[model samples]
Target: RIDAETRRILLLELQVRPGIAALQSEQLVAKAFKTKVNMLRSLGSRVVMTVLEEVLPAAAREAFRKATSSSGAAGAGRGVRPAASTAAPEPMPVAPEEHALAARPPPAAAPPNAPQPAAAPHAE
Candidate 1:
């Protein structure tokens, strides 16, 4: 299961470097996670775009769109039109339960006052 922290980090990376082609970026991420590049890349540009659209703030999204459009246009004079600047859609709010679960810190030393369970009976 992908954790919230990991997702946040990935989103931040994507936001900071949206000029990288989605496939290349996914390959890098898959390597970092010791997974098959195709597994991640298979999710496709739409998923990556959706994640960026959801996570980045309006200004960041605008910057990303501009940068991507410019880079695509520059490549072989592709003549790609700049994506229209639009207000960023509201981020899908993380569910309260998910937020609560994510916010909880890992248990500290199994708690100081908790009773230790009896050791399992020794086998012969």
Candidate 2:
């Protein structure tokens, strides 16, 4: 049997828990519960997140949820789009000859007509 104390406790608990809506409800009990919840929600209780969206009519919020969930990257409830990521460009392919040349040391500058070492012949 439900008592005044039980109802009072449930109402107080509702402030911290929005899911306090009872699963087992008779017609009268449900009506009483809804009335109490509506009163509390109308006062913009911190427990009910709907207070932040009080400016929007209920239908508009539902529609936005559906629209964003299906096709848009729109963030949850904030109406913001996710940022796109940028990729680095692929490197150009290096030729074998060019690579060898680039790896070689720079030739030293010599005085005019300075004697140079003779090139060694490759063995067959």
Which is the leading candidate under TM-score? 1
The per-prediction CA RMSD against the true structure, in angstroms, equals 17.0, 23.8
Candidate 2 local distance difference test against the native: 0.61
Stretches of candidate 2 above 4 Å error?
A: 1-85, 112-124
lDDT of 2 at 66: 71
lDDT of 1: 0.67
Residue 51 of model 2, lDDT score: 48
Error of 2 at 24 (Å): 93
User: CA lDDT, every prediction?
Assistant: 0.67, 0.61
- Alpha carbon RMSD to native, model 2: 23.8
Tens digit of per-residue lDDT, candidate 1, span 48-85: 56788899998998897787667753453333234667
The sequence of per-residue lDDT tens digits that candidate 2 reaches over residues 1-124 is: 5578866665565443544445533434555777776676455433233543676687886775576567744543342234446887789999999999999999988988999899999999
